[model samples]
Target: MYVAVKGGEQAIARSLELLAEARRGDVAVPALELAQIREQLRLGVARVMQEGSLYDEELAALAIRQAAGDMLEAIFLLRAYRTTLPRFGYSQPLDTTAMRVRRRVSGTFKDIPGGQVLGPTYDYTQRLLDFDARQPAQVACADAPLPANMPRVLDLLDAEALIEPIEPGNDPEPIDLTREPLTFPADRAARLQNLARGDEGFLLGMAYSTQRGYAESHPFAGEIRMGEVDVWVCPEELGFAIEIGSITLTECQMINQFQGGNGVPPQFTRGYGLAMGEGERKAMAMALVDRALRCDELAESNDAPAQNQEFVLSHSDSVEASGFVQHLKLPHYVDFQAELSLLRTLAARHHEDTDDTPLCKHGGARP
Candidate 1:
């Protein structure tokens, strides 16, 4: 086994130089500014912020630029930056009931308190390339006003006692996942936190598995809403909460059938998901995974991949996953050399065993 310690050092440095050159491309073209990424590629920035578990648009934009538009790397950069920040007092839980909703839809009901308002969604758009994006054009707005606050669809079911009622402060205090190591049989809060920061594609695949009969779940998008929700924080001296800021969020509430288990009457159960910014798909997938992981709570079978807490939470973080996968490209001379020597020893033993074995010279079958 050859170790290229000296040559590898020079090669890595040169590779970095080439990467910088490739990232910038020609000198004539203007470099992409942070503002451009923040405004033009706003969705990417939002996803980076959500997955990174940080809410700073400026920092997310800067990370996107620095990562050369690689989303996982941008998320990694944002997470790294967030770890260095001071830990201020924790904010009070956000009130989504008071959200200034921009889009609200319900698959379960056609007519709710607020009519279905499909605002800023690509659900019905034709999958065609826009040739006009090459040239700037003035976009016109149509005036169709919706109410500021729309009632949650699930609330309607709760009124009739058709769904479970979650009293405020009934559950245990949530564990701060970042500060503590994840253990088996995690609580709902820990699982949701991990899923919020989970890779979108991985969750999507896991969620899809349930639909394909990997697990038993029949879900309806009871309600999906996107809006700006106020964040509040209370200082010890103040003794009351004050609005700190407002951030865009997407909330998905999934309704699933609970077939009379755990000494509970047959009724509808809820799986909830909420994500920073307008990430409806991520929220939906998260809701499905959340429901799947709640087998024990529901007294259902936990014989599925999505139901396994260790399997899902352990591999959720994009930052950790990206680091581990990308680290393979780096030097592994010592590790490979050890494996090579082991393989040679095994081969020599196999050859000696073959030489020791007795062989019949006759081609015919033994009597």
Candidate 2:
């Protein structure tokens, strides 16, 4: 039975009110302060900042709280907030080589210069859940002085002719993706920016696919560094670059073996990934997927799902994926009715044609 459905406005209003109430939680209990979230839920804040392409910790934390701890929704919230923000100016390419390294590691070499500093990593921790909500304990401060700066492991490789060298230059201005639509055949910078803001799960899945004989890319994690990098920009009037604050970044560079193809000799190839915060998994996954997407350029077989640029890049953002998938719950009655009418007509026509056909193939007698 078809009934005229109404009250969409009321439903939406109620939904909004419920969302607000849920986000706030019980009024009796103290509301979560932004600082508490930023400090305690650092990982969640980092994820939101990484995926949202915004480095503000406090804002990311607020988004997380508002989204009720939903990471993807938090990312969406941050992105929406980001759209309304005014861009002051572009920052110059960060000098990661001069990064104040907290954690740096290289997988390609057994030993490298500056040595491996596995600083503050959860990689080796047991997965057993801790059932205690212990109070924060203070640790004694170290009296010894810390290192002023640390060099990148990859720079040591560059010293030798083992790894391909990247030259420093004035990076061309980047187009704002929010302000402008993404176009096909994006440049390396553009692609990296897209991948950095992309959904972690989606990128991880694509990376996993490449390893499972999809793109057949033999990738090695050349280096993964997590630290604070200085952001600089040269205003035309200033005529020189100025440091515009620092941001924590996780950068991953994947080394791939490219056999002689596309007129290029057998050489070590590169796949790069950089995130706004400590997002090692996302960065590594992004590097693999980035290389997989470049199969055509390297003249590799492009039969894999990972190698399909359109498919990989298009579905990489959680915001877009979640919205479109959930949007089916919205109004679609017109389309549904059309489909229903077409199916009924097809069924009736098929039955009528069958009924008209004789039961016996030879002459026309009813059984």
Candidate 3:
């Protein structure tokens, strides 16, 4: 349906030139280095990597710069670049229990095993901006190094047999969503994969809706940990796992009250979310929505929009949504002309029919 126009090739080229010039802005200003964006605007870089489904910080920074700091566009750029990459062996499942804890907190408990280690966060800071550029302040050092592996707060509840147990090893192998087209009645693994790369803003809104009585899962932020976790890969030839590298991650575990159904006893349920880099908000939002989507599996009411898997998964990709909505700006000349011709024909037919009829004083056409 999209026929290429013969003309305007030169104009498009000129427009692209203008776009490039505009992206550079004033030449007087120094160009932004990829390293600066990757380090200084780390959160933005993390969001790009998370949504783009790519973990290369340098590339993410480049995409961000190329997109002129447009987060969604940056995500799209990174994702587009990712499609051309060659497939390598998949990494082993991350072990969060062994994370080099930088930040760990829990709303369910005040004093968790590794008392709250509040890392660099904007939570307690004043919103006021300082006009003067200030030097970095010195950070106080901890008396003792943190334990190699901190015990998960959820484990305490698990010990009491209060929360549902997620036993490992029995679940089927998860499919690569990138290579496979998503189908209806998707399993939890697929759903989680979709959500992990979903637009953060969309997920946040859906999660907020759940709290506003839409799905009404009595959710508590059981634990949110941000740190670096080692990535391992096992090659077919080697038959042994090797540490490829480590990547920063944020993991959120949400506890929700569940009056068990489907022939199960009442027990607390859990919703999990994980993201690349320090993406606490994204992780938390994902967790809430994840729980809401589990309504069918948990035998709860699936009346809310958040519980609609089709709607959520379909609309979650910012790149796809942006393309579909923005494509209206494209040349629909043929389609528009057809519609206009049809309308004109209908109007002419009505006018011709009216010309042979007599109009009464009340403006009604007389037979």
Candidate 4:
């Protein structure tokens, strides 16, 4: 049996009107331009693209504007738009090692090939409010031209047989998570893909948990690189791969100590993360969660929340989480009425049964 609620249309219309008014409050102030958001709030755009699994900056910016500055809503809009596009072809696996080195840093090495090129970072910026009406723009020029190519820090450790080796040729064909439903015991590629789009705050908290003795992890930022990487696609007619422009990316390689088990010698283990645009925090947090999720493969204890893939991946999406949590505000009168009726029936039955019974010493009624 179903009974539809009434008067929701007027409420929804009024709510939408209120939202529009709120979104463009006070016509005196200039409306936010899409280009402004694209240029100034690039990090926010990058986050939307990464989570939405779409790389179009312009569309992301538009989505951001339409979402009224709500990042999660922007991500949802982008993701919904992504579903309408037809699949052309899958791009080749990106080679982050060949990134046109920009901001490269390593915590384990004091001096590496790139010499800790902190190209653009807020590490040294003082958290102070600016009082000046007009702020001066920074003028930066590279000092002692950076090396065109820098060796990955983990590769250096691999050369000396200090870290567990990743056989380049033996990787399994990655499952297309976008097409297939994600299941338990996911492969490394699937896990990486899932984490790549996982909610930033959620993954950040999970990563922080690992650092706080949740998973017994002692991880180091072996390398955190931000640069441009070329995208390639192979066409059936061409029989060869062609470059499809390049996009900026941030890659994080976390190195964690691993005690040998499962017939493998003790060595440093690796966790990889790659994100669209300059998303170092996302990359780093993904790396940490990646390492934590590999507890079983690395022969470590799986007693932490990060290690639970079902729990982590299920709640990782902003769109799904927001829908579920926000849906609580919707009308539930019918369901509530059903529960109320059941409670009344139970009370009546209980009263009938106890009507002829005497009061117990401990209480007024029993059963």
Candidate 5:
């Protein structure tokens, strides 16, 4: 193989230089600052952070800049960096009910306890390109401040026992997916963790499949909220939890109709999703796929690709998938040469066998 040749090292070094040159583009253009990416390309940073399984905005922005706007490469960079950091004590589970609401909406209800607060969304705007994006825009202010906390719509259903309750402590103690190997028949905690870090586009397609009858999970957006949620952690010596920090989060709670099965009465089930930053689409897609993966647990028929845990989880990470696919670009000289030799030998043997056979009319080989 060429790798065993003397010039292999020099070739790799030259390739690296070419890659660096290409990544920078024309030197006349100004380089993107980390803050610029963090502020302007926030949704891209959010996706990198979510898929990277890390929450640092600055690092995510840096990764994006380093990858030259390639999202999968940025995710790979961040994930590589994340593995080197030392492990710290885990933070306590977040309480979303206490989230300081910024954007809240419910597809299931037109008017709810908290009137729909549409904060900074593109849904109402025209899809036309803005030629004057660089110009400063006039802004409007609300007459009064929004309430600090709003009740979750799903809780209303839970009040009447119409929906299944999801109490935190009921599940098994969660393990860090990065530190341990994933085992089959994964619990909800592990599955949710996997989906939280899954590729958004992949989950989005899978979710869409469910709506198209691949896995019929008749779903309604019970609530979709985006805001800052306080993070708390407890030290062993303190014996009580204290506020560490707050992080922007988007949460989606999906209400799905479930008929009676496995000795359970007919009721509305739940599919939950949470993502870092304002990732409404990612969160919603995650919720749909999360519900689909729970077919076995919910005693529903597992007949769809989305419902298959092994297939989904194994290919969800963009970093892993990209590496497996992109590795094909690497040197495979030896392997290709062996295949070429085999094909030529087969061709030669076919010609030798047919040469001795008599050709009848119509140029056909006779037995």
Candidate 6:
């Protein structure tokens, strides 16, 4: 009645066939085109691009389709693909102040210069499902052309020295996390890069924990902006920087009031987060967590989960988390057998001790 399972090759082949069929749903219906997904499901594509660490909408859309709409899986696919590609060169530091603003808003102020433009957002829409999405509808385009460049609200504060000024200079370059192993006491750039590709849900949970008296950061979202910024890179031979390309980025600045300690005066501190694509939620969450992790630098009490940099950054990736968790399903008979033997020995010893008669009773019976 009991037979060892065989034909693993056949089983694997069948599973692949089934997966391909499922990914391609109905033969009669045309396949979900990559361009369609990129344009129509732009938000989903954006999420994939943000977490995937690759700013390619078309590839992100394809990964989404291949992964059957699982965002994390799509991210994994994109990351894997990105690893195979050769690195040409590094891009120049983006000028966010000159970003072609699509959507910009500031939570700290009532109104600021370069007035807030809430472009193409679902923020106001009620979360109701529309049953009449049979075909996409076209709306008439606006007659007026948008501005080419928009100044950041922070720059206004920077001019007055109301905000902490970040001096622009060539800081030490960061090590690539993909190529190099992560070490403790990481710099801000490296930490930010890790958090950008981090799992949104995990980071969000950790960020929420801080709000609930964990790290206890009184954070105000100073500003959150989404738009395209030109990436420029200066090759050693070029002698000057040139525009490489433009990338969509979401940047978040968090202001946390820290009564200064550690020989520093009280000042409004800053936490920053920037992502490669339109990822407002992730960027915002990352900013909060980033500030929390900098407790030591800010002289704030480091007593929360988010404040533990090693713990937070190390476990933020879903791909790593998922792989380690699911690896338990693989064969562990040897370890299981070892545990079983130990339990059996303990049980046998217990039984023998319970069954033993008193030595006095045995001597009396003999007498």
Off by over 4 Å in 6: 1-6, 140-146, 159-162, 354-367
Pull out the clashing pairs in model 1. none
What's the number of clashes in each of the models?
0, 1, 0, 0, 0, 2
Return the candidate ranking by lDDT, descending.
3, 5, 4, 1, 6, 2
Instruction: Give model 2's clash tally.
Output: 1
Candidate 4 lowest-lDDT run of ten? 1-10
Model 1: residue 271 alpha-carbon error in angstroms: 1.1
Which candidate's lDDT is highest?
Answer: 3
Q: What is the TM-score (0 to 1) of candidate 5?
A: 0.93
What digit string (tens of lDDT, one per residue) describes model 2 on residues 49-104?
98887899999998988889999989999988898989877777678878888788
lDDT for residue 126 in candidate 1, whole number 0-100: 92
Which of the two, 5 or 6, has more lDDT? Answer: 5
Residue-level lDDT tens digits of model 3 in 1-367:
1234434776798899998999999999999999999998999999999999999999999999999999999999999999999998799889999999989999999988979888889899787896553766566887788778899999999999999997886889999999999998989999999999999999999999999999959899999999999999999999999998999999999999999777777889999999999899999999999999999888788999999999999999999999899999988988999999999999889989878666889999875
- Candidate RMSDs in order: 3.7, 3.8, 3.2, 3.5, 2.8, 4.3
Instruction: Name the candidate, 2 or 4, with the larger lDDT value.
Output: 4
For each candidate in the order shown, give its overall lDDT on alpha carbons.
0.88, 0.83, 0.93, 0.89, 0.92, 0.83
lDDT of 5 by residue, 1-367 (tens): 5756658888888989998999888999998889999998999999999999899999999999889899999999999999999987889989999999999999998988888999978899999999898897887888689999999888888899888877767777897899998889898889999999999999999999999999859999999999999999999899999998999999999999999777788899999899999899999999999999999988888889999999999898888899999999988988999999999999889989878666889899876
What TM-score does structure 3 among the candidates reach? 0.92
In the predicted model 3, the residue pairs found to clash are none
lDDT for 365 in candidate 2 is 67
Q: Give a tens-digit lDDT track for model 1, residues 1-367.
A: 1466778778889999998898888989999999989888878988999899999999999998888999998999999888888888888888898898888999999998979888888899897998977887787784766787788899988999888788987878888877888888889999999999899989988889888877779899999999999989999999999988899999999999888766788889888888888899999999999999998888889899988888988998888888899999877889999999999999889979876454467754345
Model 1 misplaced stretches (Cα beyond 4 Å) = 1-7, 142-144, 356-367
TM-score of every model?
0.93, 0.89, 0.92, 0.92, 0.93, 0.89
Show the colliding residue pairs in model 5. Answer: none
